[model samples]
Target: MDNIGKRIKHIRKINNMIQTEFAGLIGIGQGTLSEIEQGKLKPSIDTLYELSKHFQIDLNWLVMGAFECMNLKEYEYELLRKTRELDLDCQNEVAEFIEFK
Candidate 1:
């Protein structure tokens, strides 16, 4: 489990996504993702890029286990996603509330 594949699998698990869903989001087949997770194959650069971009994964940590996999937990990511959908004024209010708390 000390490889890129394992790390990617970890990301998927923490996000509560199954292989089919995770692979679909990354534009890869389930079989390919399975092989990668099993450490029988390495992920391509494009896949790596997608993983980092879509899941907010840290590339350095994904490739080298150099740091934390993600700076935010799943709940925090969900909160941020929801915040981004709010109107600007509401967003500001939410930020202010969080800061005050």
Candidate 2:
């Protein structure tokens, strides 16, 4: 797999999300996501942001494979990951808390 594909695959696997499910979450087709993972296709910026936001991955890491992009705290990453599993209201509460902080 290519760099981007490798990172995408790693994030998805670590999150325990299947390609079809992940694709659906990202508003992409399963086939498109599969092709992306195979390095046969490049995802759009919107798609990249969707994946990054949903998976709580660094956008630079997702786009440029930059592991050193940001020094994110483990708890911060955990919070981001868990937030995706929350319902909209719960997520809004978390967002509001962050904003208030």
Candidate 3:
């Protein structure tokens, strides 16, 4: 599976969300979510944020693979803004660096 796919699956499982249920919460078709989880397609930035909101995860972590899993606040309106500021692809590399250090 691609990085995006793994991230999606990881977050979903971490949150205890089933694919079908999570897809509903994210307002996407389960088939599409499944494809994304399977690494068949890339999600747009908007979609990424939506999933982050649904999962209450750090947007930057979700997109770039930076933090393994950010514990985002339920009502943090600015979380998305902070998440967008992070450079794309920073999450995965950051996670690795954190692990190595």
Candidate 4:
């Protein structure tokens, strides 16, 4: 685990993609990919952006090796979790009981 390279390798392996396949998907040759993974070459910002685009991940996560991939607020998470717990059987009754009357 050598920081960026390690994270890249970790993510790649987690996704079940070989270095060659990941490299090809990201538009880099296997040799260049090897160099990057070995820390022989730091990826340029543009390259990082391209990699982010390729993986649909934030460039900051790729560059800084940030552990969090999502930024869900605690309240948002709780609200969503609570919303899912509402019984569907009572949904229509609940909806019809508006307080306006």
Pairs of residues at least 3 apart in sequence or in different chains that clash in candidate 4: none
Residue 89 displacement in candidate 1 (angstroms): 12
What tens-digit string does per-residue lDDT give for candidate 2 at 2-100?
378777887788789999998999999999999988888988999998987776777876787554345655455556667977999999998899899
Number of clashes found in candidate 1: 0
Q: Which of candidates 2 and 4 is the stronger one according to lDDT?
A: 2
Q: Which stretches of candidate 3 lie over 4 Å from their true place?
A: 68-101
Least well predicted 10-residue stretch by lDDT in candidate 1: 66-75
- What are the per-residue Cα lDDT tens digits for candidate 4 across 40-97? 8876676677676765555565776443445655354334434454778665455566
Residue-wise C-alpha lDDT for candidate 1, range 11-91, written one tens digit per residue:
898779999999999999999999999999999999999998887666776787664355555466557656866889999
What TM-score, over all chains together, does every model reach?
0.67, 0.65, 0.59, 0.58
Best by TM-score: 1
Instruction: Evaluate residue 29 in candidate 3 and report its C-alpha lDDT on the 0 to 100 scale.
Output: 83
* Local distance difference test, each candidate: 0.84, 0.79, 0.69, 0.65
Clashing pairs in model 3, backbone N/Cα/C closer than 3 A: 64-91, 65-91, 65-92, 66-91
For model 1, how big is the CA root-mean-square deviation?
4.4
| Clash number for each model | 0, 0, 4, 0
What is residue 57's positional error in candidate 4, in angstroms? Answer: 1.6
